[model samples]
Target: MKYPILCCISLLGSLTAFTSSATTCPEILSSKQRLLNSTENIELCEAFQGKTLLVVNTASQCGYTSQFEELEELYQTYKDKGFTVIGFPSNDFRQDRGSEEQSAKVCYLDYGVTFPMMARSSLTGSSANPVFTQIQSQAGVKPKWNFYKFLINKQGKVVATFPSSTSPVSSTLKNAIEQQL
Candidate 1:
């Protein structure tokens, strides 16, 4: 009886996969990025297409570093509703020690971040990453410090930018997210 149930479950899983078709990622999200502490490259569009995103430029050593907990809470609450919090660790402000391994440890082990965090990259100026560059051009804002956040809608548009002092759990941010969803 147990073996039959297991077999049926496996068969159902296979059938579900067979019926589902893969979605093509949008051109805007086609840029390849690396996960923190790993060399594997991932296409951003394939991973987060059709999702409302809260993009944050984070630093492990910053004063507002505790926001990681709130960010994780936001992800836990709204993730099921097609919302995601994306983090990119940046050391441009000289707050971080410029170490990927340490950043990964703080994000994964210390803060217990379940949301996706990319490798360290510049968040402002000429050396900024493509994602940040596009966001700045569209929103007319640049990160003033570590922990700056940019909210992106499902259509890949920068809807809002929050400064370092804004908490991830703030009603203002939550309301903005709810509007998109």
Candidate 2:
């Protein structure tokens, strides 16, 4: 009886310590977003806290849609080094496919994207989602077109913003990611 009680107490203390050290959601990543083609939603900070992130606003029919391949390659290259790429499909520029299924198919099957691609959402102006709104506030700019990217450090700071024309594998973006890692 004494041994069991001691073990229980020890376990309780361990759980307390673990909870205390867990990362809290920063204001920028505080919103919950649904994953593409899934009913499930993930709290951004819970999924990405302490990770270097490249957040991209994507569109299925844009000229820059091919950037998904390069983005995936970039993700695979440095994903193990505390880095991640998060894609958010948006239609604010009026280039997305007709529906969520089409968008998910483009991301998951057509592009073979293995990174996290969120469900379609508004990505510009007053209707922008919480994450992008916060990003614009911090970065001083918002997505002017599809495939715009924002690099965020582990501390949730927006380190850099790249326009639609900047390739994911471009030296400037890669160097910034490397520095953050």
| Local distance difference test values of all predictions, in order | 0.88, 0.92
Name the lDDT value of residue 25 in candidate 2. Answer: 55
As a whole number from 0 to 100, the lDDT of residue 136 in candidate 2 is 84
Best by lDDT: 2
Model 1 scores a TM of 0.84
Residue-pair clashes per candidate: 0, 0
Q: What is the lDDT of residue 101 in candidate 2?
A: 93
Model 1 clash tally? 0
Please give the distance, in angstroms, between residue 2's alpha carbon in candidate 1 and its true position after superposition: 48
Residues 26-139, model 2: lDDT tens digits: 678888999988999998888998899999999999999999999999999999999999999998989996989999889889989999988889976777888898898898
